[model samples]
Target: MFNLRTRDQIRRVETGKSTSNTTNGNGSTSQFGFSSMDGERQPLLGHQATTTLHAEPGFWRHLLFSAKSSPGTNSPNPFVRWPAQVWNVTKITLFSSWINLLLVFVPLGIVAGELKWGAPWVFTLNFFAIIPLAAVLSFATEEIAGRLGETLGGLVNATFGNAVELIVSIVALRAGEIEVVQSSMIGSILSNLLLVLGMCFFLGGIYNMRGQDGHGHEQSFSTATAQTTCSLMTLASASMILPAALYGVLSQAEEDNKQASILVLSRGTSIILLFLYCLYLYFALRTHQKLFEPEVSQVSDSDTGEEEHEPLLGPWAAALVLVVTTLVISVCADHMVDSIDALVATGKISKTFIGLILIPIVGNAAEHVTACVVAIKDKMDLAMGVAIGSSIQIALLVTPALVMLGWAIGQPMTLHFETFETVAFALSVLVVTYTVQDGKSNYLEGAMLLGLYIIIALAFWVSPTGALGKV
Candidate 1:
């Protein structure tokens, strides 16, 4: 029998997005339906959830269908339905996978660096090389997770989704690029919260605003998720606040005890943060898992209908691909880090800009795009999960893990960020919390977030290189 849960699963499968569904009970069989961005339902024929959309129609076909079948007294105006049409085009083009072709730049980067190519050239090649490798890593992870069922799949995706950024940070840490690592950490959180999420809300607002009456349907953001995200961001701000204060007080003290005290405090804080993160995962996946499930809104009395399930790559094959792609990312990151000094030495850009802007963008490009795409499709829950979830991981998992890893390798990384970075981090958390409090969003709110991010970015861009000390 088709229920709300089953109907949502069928919708995902029909659109070629893979998700695991388990039948809970039995009921009367009914026709399948596709849900539009405005929560409107269109009926289609099917029973099994594994049924695939064979030879799916192109953008024009869907647009025409949407225009003709739309229930209204007004004419079939494309402008009124621009968001839906744009999404249709996005769905078609997503399959092109042209980024895979950029993989060739990996070996080319290695060759250029070995042949004494200039810093700018090597950095450019290696930076571009990381983008495709990051995509490959993401694809391989998704393929493996698709086979693991929803609960475990969500866990895996949350844990490993930011592998590219983590890898880059680790490589930079090894090379004594503490400022670079620190800036990138804050940058990842900012980019996800502001840039990526803003785009999602902005596009979602546009789509929802184009509904029949033009006021648009209210986007159903998960209140549970939003509250939890705000709490986590608060925790992140607290974690950094103490360290930043401690760094300031100790900076004027004896150098001998200053570094030692900071290291001890950092290691202790890292341990605590890691413990907190584990608790969060347990609460999210085990204790309150139901709160995290996708909420379905029924626009009609739908009947039982099944759709074809999309298959995934074999586990072993997916694992192998993940391993190989991650290894390639590591190599490229090493070269990229090696070239950072050269690039900044030329006076064209600051280290802050490189870390806060360039590095995070390169590593997270694929995930960023995925977040926006899901938002465009009106999957606000999943979109928030991607954006907010990644930020939490960076704060609780990646930052602490890097600190511990650095200590283990004798590099002794501390959580002590500069004054400006500390302020920016705190401000970001406060602003995002305010925006998400109502569990609603619009393009204007999104623009506000983006505007704040731009201001912070410009501040960093103009700061002289090395002005911020390495703690």
Candidate 2:
């Protein structure tokens, strides 16, 4: 009799027709529908209607059970739901790319470090480990940024996209590897400006040409935005040149306190650059935001059917993943830094080559791939932002931050790069300036950038470590 009564009540609630009324202990009459034990009204079980629930869930419940479960499944144990949601998010994040197969290296890296493995083993394992970790970091950062809307999202992306470089640099700086810190900083800038941007132009040109009914096609981005970014790069180049010039002039004069003078100058300049970065952010995000807004281009008929994927994780889950990934990256970076001396002592590679070429490649690999993929889709503005904007952050933000960090830590990290590196950086910026000056890109321009990068890499590979000392 009780079971039959419950069935009739559920049917009435499902139909959204509560015919019965109940008298509460306080003499208040209430409609007999779905209600919690606390007398709060619940939504009809089968009524296909939109309703807003004002209940606030607990923090742990919100975090763990944010993702909806699959349809038609019976309610499992409460303990199983959180883990299942986590597993779903993890699977989506890690298995999205074949590169994540390298994640096996993360644990291998830790094991190698703990087992007292040789420097080669540890370095190799940790180096590869950072690659997938970088990819995951990029993914999680985008997921979180997506929820923040465009203006704040761009800021979040700029800060966290370079988190790996920042982490590795901090580790090296703390270890007194000033050269490693400086080289990695410039390397990241070069890789983004030349290698990543070059690939974007090249692939974008090729893809557009194939998609369109033309032989000599060109991909174009916003000229004003490109000019603004290039001007900043020019300023960064000037910053590099001025310090090296000061060092040179002082050394030529036989000044007794040259290093001390340069140290003070570098610290002051870093603070100024950081200020300039803040201004740039304000200009881009607040005052003149429309200038940086992405320009829409006509999509080709072949591309119109493609769908964008929604973020796999909620903001909280993404933030959690980001924190976890960063911690893992720090562990891997520490292991890698510990092995650098041994790796260099083998005579097979120099510290300069490792810092300038190899380390930046690891740090910027995911970003490089992302820029090229977007460029191929003809989203030149976004591609340019990823490529050139990243370089700007490294130059105007990360480099300055490292100098400040070094000051606090008693290391002499400075803007004074080697003469050759400064020259390469200047020339690379010049080439990019010219390439983007007209707001048009073609395969030839891209080929030129890649050619120049290859030349620079070869020169570094042959140059001995410490041979090109700071000016």
Over the stretch 92-208, how does candidate 1's per-residue lDDT look in tens digits?
Answer: 223324576787789999887778689999999998888878877776666566657666776666667789999999999999998899999999999988898888888877777
CA deviation > 4 Å runs, candidate 2:
1-77, 210-213, 252-256, 298-309
Across 218-295, the per-residue lDDT of candidate 2 in tens digits comes to 888888889999999999999999989998888566554887777888889999989998889888877887777555
Alpha-carbon TM-score of each model against the true structure: 0.78, 0.82
lDDT of each: 0.71, 0.75
Model 1 Cα shift for residue 342 (angstroms): 1.0
TM-score of predicted model 2?
0.82
Top-scoring candidate (lDDT): 2
